[model samples]
Target: MVLGVLGALLVPSLSSPASAAGDATVVVRGTDLPVGGPIELSYVGCARLYERTAEVPQPFVGLGPDQAPAGERSLRYDLAGGTALGSLSYARSMASTTTSGLSVQAPRGAAGVAWVGYQEPADFGTTTYWFGRADVSAPAGAWTSVETTGLTYTWSRYDMATRRAVGGATAAPSTLAAMIAERGDGPGFRTVGFGCDGNRFALDALRVGDATGTTTYDLEGLTTTTVMAARPAPRGTVLTGVLRDGSGEQVVRGTLVLERQVAGGWETVQVVPAEAVDATVTVAPEQTTTYRWRFADRPLAEGSVSEPTTVTVAPGQETSQEPTQQPTRQPAQR
Candidate 1:
């Protein structure tokens, strides 16, 4: 895997041209190029990155007609739609403050980017280069990530109103998995749903405009659902919330549900069916609990749930919420 801020150019072979030219001389060409989109960055490196750039740099080629050795990996193309090259920036942050700037031809899109830097698989010295489509435009927002190989980039359509990233950075499959170590790809970019991964993150508040953003994924690392039977002696032993109608009638056997934030995203932890009285949720004690649940999917949207309830099991507390506390035996005085 070659790491780099700028995508190296590609070599023109008998089957491939030096550039992808089209009838429209508008600049970046090709339907694949994300036009009027945001900016995204990724890193890729190999032996070739260290190579000194002469007056001009060579372009990296993609999987060509020529095949590599059976065991070796082939150099594939890394590009945005219309063969858009990446936009790079460097910055520093401290005490929650950030200072940053970008270095590229076009501030946002491919308007100024003319080259894509490519390196040999594993070996950076074996590099190639390819110019981008002339019509390449500028990116709106920027998303950048650095890896062992190089820095990754993402340019997106910025929601000028909320000042958040709504569009996605075109990323490789490996990139997604690496972002969420233990996550699996499901429906709606479910692999790395809305969350932070110490990278240029695309954040949103889950609005109706963001149809592609609202992803549904199964949460991992649930460990176990410890049960704490309810008891009358203790006002409450099992963590729970009451469900009722506008009239305030005891909603017996209605439903209970749990949502958990994991792997840089939120997912359903538990879902109690309708007509189920209270719910007995099991979880290890932790801080900063952020989750949401659906009560009465029936649309009445009646009762409001208790703000994400958190519990801290003391040192010797019984797993089950018993009415009385167990006797504590002090260690023998040394």
Candidate 2:
């Protein structure tokens, strides 16, 4: 189940992308990129996040392939549609503020963006809103890149007099280049955000370009899986486990807990530090036991657990009389 968000603040839907308040209401840190940059992904409406899983595919080519071997995870939002609507958005905070508030910048022709599903462009300020939408650039399950140099989009400006967005009058369809030309730049483009209001989709590799340079944000979470070296071996058989990151690379940081299934829940058997890229451990059980690795949550990576691997002791194998080393008993850390 997806983590539930409080409040039922209704915003404009996809049909009227530029009618009122923007989608993102709860702004929080999602995850950090490998490039040492923070990606603050805000969830809009009833959006539910589905992290690293084989069911949903990531947008990148060599990353999250839509086939077998689940690739890297994508920042996905699954909307139930009808009354339950959802979207994913990101905003650049003002450079001078201490908080993560939105920033206001002058319109620039160098501004460009890319998404996977329905895109909604929003401009937020104090009692000021400007919403716009363009033709669907990409299909349902693909990535689309748009250079704001010459792209024309239908825009709707908010009218304080009537307390609503006035379309076909004060605001008309305009291109990104034309907006910058008319405004002539200088702190008017406050709070620029883009998102999708589709049923189920993902957003990844957000490359936003400006006059200075372009930064690509690869939004993802950590993933872990474990396997037993020998199954159905003798009572003294050794068990080993391997750990990896989201990109299928060996995990070289943090600690992993070795858990064994108990009557109530899983119990921590050993606390192993991931000194090397792939963490390996050896354990010998007297009877058949099921085990898995549990990775704790960190600032850069969310917590994850591996599939269960049960090792059955050979029925007629001669049992060793030597006593096994006692494992330190403790609860599984988050």
Top model by TM-score, which number? Answer: 2
* Candidate 1 structure quality by residue, lDDT tens digits, 216-253: 11101101121223222343334444555533444433
Question: Which residue pairs clash within candidate 2?
Answer: none
- Give each model a TM-score: 0.20, 0.39
